[model samples]
Target chain A: GESVGLHLPTLSVQEGDNSIINCAYSNSASDYFIWYKQESGKGPQFIIDIRSNMDKRQGQRVTVLLNKTVKHLSLQIAATQPGDSAVYFCAENGLKGGADGLTFGKGTHLIIQP
Target chain B: DAGITQSPRYKITETGRQVTLMCHQTWSHSYMFWYRQDLGHGLRLIYYSAAADITDKGEVPDGYVVSRSKTENFPLTLESATRSQTSVYFCASSSGGNNEQFFGPGTRLTVL
Candidate 1:
């Protein structure tokens, strides 16, 4: 059984500060990872993604770092804003032959202290 | 627009009753998934379909059933709802293996 887990269940940060969310996966065969953001009442939106071959990938103001050796993945948000506050989830896609579905981690609630 | 949508944004049903949640995608993605989000459990996959008429159970598929009659539609039905089954349900679709999945606005199910 493959499992994706997060280090923290909740994260509180002040506006204008940087936010970092960490995730650890148990499946070493996972080659693809994605970071998703979900608002209070909305669906999960794709933030960024990285392949096992690459260690890092950047989006508008977000960066995803993957440490395959340690089976760790992290999402970094620069200049965090109030709108960036949401539950962030990390998912792993390691199913061989496309039989396995994405495994999501317990999300980290990002609360912004304005 | 290319996106995924879930019907009946909110649902309230009684225990032992059957309830169905509808999921539709416009991208014609090959992969569709159903997940339930709980307070501490996060998002657990209930079922997924690789293509039309092909489906499989996921981590928590005990009380759920899914059918993929069409590529754009994947619906999940709870044959006998229970109090423990009350949770937010989400439907998502992806283009291919290990690709980014687009999610729909979740349907909040309350089993009374």
Candidate 2:
């Protein structure tokens, strides 16, 4: 009965501006969360991940923020570029002593304007 | 040089026909998953195999079946394809539970 959902379906940002995508989850038991980027024809690619113990994690040009109290997660991209345009997905992992499987969200389409 | 791969990148079949989508992983991961992506519905898990001969149904397992005869292969079959079955199928594998999954190029199926 756990689900991950995005706050927005589409986002548009200027080429040089920053972008923030938000996600909300309903499973408090989920301790692991991952962000994936999927291009038009390719499969989802791992972007960054964060565990419950930590509130934030940073990658090359992206940062993931987690708020356990509010059951919310977000991905931030600095200096957005045209190549960063893609569909972003948030997935949750709550094995709970069982085989770990991911529950994916509906995805947010990011459009970077050049 | 080893990763996940899916066969029949594109497929078109008539209703009531039987079709199978093949998935192979060279990582020899213990966990493999099958998912279908549709507009507005996102990616929904169909089935997953934790190991050889151990398979379990996922959120949208109806009208679909899966088998894991080996640790590196997990195939999904549609016994009787229907119009609603038209969607992009993706195969993913992870080294273990809760690990990052590596996905294959997906198979697009269109059932008429």
Candidate 3:
């Protein structure tokens, strides 16, 4: 599998630690945002999403926080495990007309150290 | 075994040759998409289909063609393969507007 993490920012965390991956998106008009995870040689997988009207959303072991004022979004993973290691991406559906599709970020590689 | 799937997980071809990448989804999602992932650029949409017999171009549609004659199959064709087109291609599907998209494993196409 080809690695999409080349030349990308990396966040290394210790096992059982909390890891936060941050993203700054463009497009003040964008209303929907999502987080995706992609392992080496694999396609992006949907992890969670947030609508513009909401400020925060939570999942099993993940939490997505959105700040419209700063156009910032963050994914907080609790008790990170080795299986959580992968490249994470933040996407927004705030394109000019919303006709195109989601605009994805470059991605962040999460390296979990035992 | 019932999900979005892509064919020819790996392909290698020459320049100026015609190549077609197949995408099929059993979920019967109304929306389908084709994207190419590069190093610096994450994933850029190449083309998409809203439904059967309906298709549209995306950010980078040049040198590519797509057709969705059936509700479950959307195939992307490269009229003339070029070295610059070498990238991992991904196909995705969504139930409807703004819904989460399910992706296939992807096809690694290499143009020589």
Candidate 4:
């Protein structure tokens, strides 16, 4: 059974618009969460990560918001571009800090419509 | 290359055959992991090693074996390949639990 999953299987956004991808987790004890961007024919690449203690974290053009109260996580890409089109995955590391590896969700395919 | 790599990017084998996938990382990370990715199921961990000679089972470990005799290499073996074992395999390494895990390109395995 998958403990983490996305709200939608696909998301389409205009090239200049913002893109939001959402994920939900079943484990309340999970502490660390990560967002990965996986381009076709390649492996998953780490985009950003947030710990349970933090509610939000931002990177270059990506922002990750964690809502522990609702057991949800989201990744927002600002001013999406064509190169941003890819499959995004959300992963969780339990209380052990991921010594056992990460639990990943199916993923959400992001399409940048020009 | 100074990054993680997997051998035989694509492979096809028959059922009941023994197959081994090799993973090598140059960073000498302390932790290495093996995962299988299917269409519907994202990445599911098969086995992980904290360090050389220290291995543990992950979410789905059946029919798979892994050994980390050296810190830089972790190989996964399937005793008897099955059709269900056909999937893309990925290898990842991290310095520790809290660090980011760098993944290999991936190996696509098909069992006929």
Candidate 5:
């Protein structure tokens, strides 16, 4: 079974528009969640993370929102740009520092339009 | 390099052959993990090690093997390559399972 999965396979947005990518996780015990961005020919790069204790965490132009009640997480990107075009993935780990590696979502491809 | 690196950015092998992919990190992180990515599927964990000689199986560990004899090196081997094994392999490390993982460039392997 898939522990995490994205709501959309691909998203196209115009430049300067705010973009939102959604993910659903089934692990009720999951405490830590992270979003990663991967460019062509590269591995996933860390974007932002949120713990179960918080509902939202904001980074530079990026915000992660966690809804434990619904078991959903979302990444909001402000002012989409060409450079922001990439695949976004959400990962979850129940133990903060345990050996249980993260389970990743299939991913959403974000395409920025001029 | 000061971060994690995977050797042979690309590889092609035949069925029933043995192949090993190498991973090395200079950060001396306490955790190392191997993941495989294929089209339409998320990266799946194959194996991981907390420290030297302390390895564990991940979500998709079948047909693959890993060893962590040293803190900085974790190698993944395929005992018998199959066409289904073709995918991009990534190696990642973190101070612990809780922290953010730093991933390598990845190795694209094709089993014929």
Candidate 6:
């Protein structure tokens, strides 16, 4: 099955610069998308989420852009900090019914270079 | 003290042995899910519970059993452990179908 995938496995960025992570999903039925950050030895923590009706959403220091036409999703971290170093994953909530589950991408490891 | 938690944080067992992983959440969320994380596979859902006494299979449910008698507890049991089952297991809970899910620290299981 053609599932959600990331263009890069690892992304390197300077401590004070901006960072962007890209994800591509094949399921056009996915109307909801979410970004999660998992630090070392920790579970995934929600970063931000966006709906198909909107093109962009912003959080404390993160922003998610959804391109429904291309089935592409991107997470932008402003003023990237060392704490932002972690594996970022994008999940699509397109499943129907009560037993449905989200489809996740392989994830992109974000490394903050000091 | 008030979030989702998984038991035995770490577990190791021999193949063919029965193993049960425990997941508990204090949020009292209506939805609970189990997922296994492997090298190539990011995260695959094992099972999910919509509410008390209601459960369903997810991406991979073979060789596994799940029971959700209570809303806050969802336990995953492996009838016969296998080396292929060695992976990081995570439990998550959500308020609703479209809500964001909160995951536990995860359980690293090793089936020798």
DockQ of each: 0.72, 0.66, 0.61, 0.83, 0.76, 0.69
Which window of 10 residues has the lowest lDDT sum in candidate 4 chain B?
A: B94-103
* Candidate 5 colliding pairs: none
Full-model lDDT for every candidate: 0.91, 0.92, 0.88, 0.93, 0.93, 0.91
TM-score pick, better of 5 and 6: 6
Evaluate residue B27 in candidate 6 and report its C-alpha lDDT on the 0 to 100 scale: 88
lDDT of 2 at A64: 99
DockQ of model 2 vs. true complex: 0.66
lDDT of 5 at A110: 98
Q: Residue-wise lDDT of candidate 6 within A33-88, one digit each (tens)?
A: 88999998889899898888999999888889988888899999999998999999
| Candidate 1: docking tier | medium
Weakest ten-residue segment in model 5 chain A by summed lDDT: A93-102
Off by over 4 Å in 2: A94-100
Tens-place lDDT digits, model 4, residues B1-112: 6699998899999999999999999998999999999998899999999999999999899999999999999999999999999999999999997667889999999999
What are the per-residue Cα lDDT tens digits for candidate 5 across A34-109?
Answer: 9999999999999999988999999999999999999999999999989999999999984333476888999999
What is the total number of backbone clashes in candidate 1?
Answer: 0
Question: Of models 1 and 2, which has the larger lDDT?
Answer: 2
Model 5 TM-score is: 0.96
* Deviating ranges (above 4 Å) for candidate 6: A97-99
lDDT of 1: 0.91
**Candidate with the greatest DockQ versus the true structure:** 4
Candidate 2 C-alpha error for residue B58, in Å: 0.4
Q: Rank the candidates by lDDT, best first.
A: 4, 5, 2, 1, 6, 3
The digit string of per-residue lDDT tens for model 3 on A1-114 reads 111122337999999999999988657888888899999999899999999999999998999999999778899999999999999998887454344566788899999999
Error of 5 at A81 (Å): 1.0
Candidate 4 residues A49-70, lDDT tens each?
9988999999999999999989
- Model 1 spans with C-alpha error above 4 angstroms: none
Candidate 5 lDDT tens digits, B29-102: 99999999998778988999999999999888999999999999999999999999999999999998787889
Which 10-residue window in model 2 chain B sums to the lowest lDDT? B94-103
lDDT of 1 by residue, A38-60 (tens): 99899999999999899999999
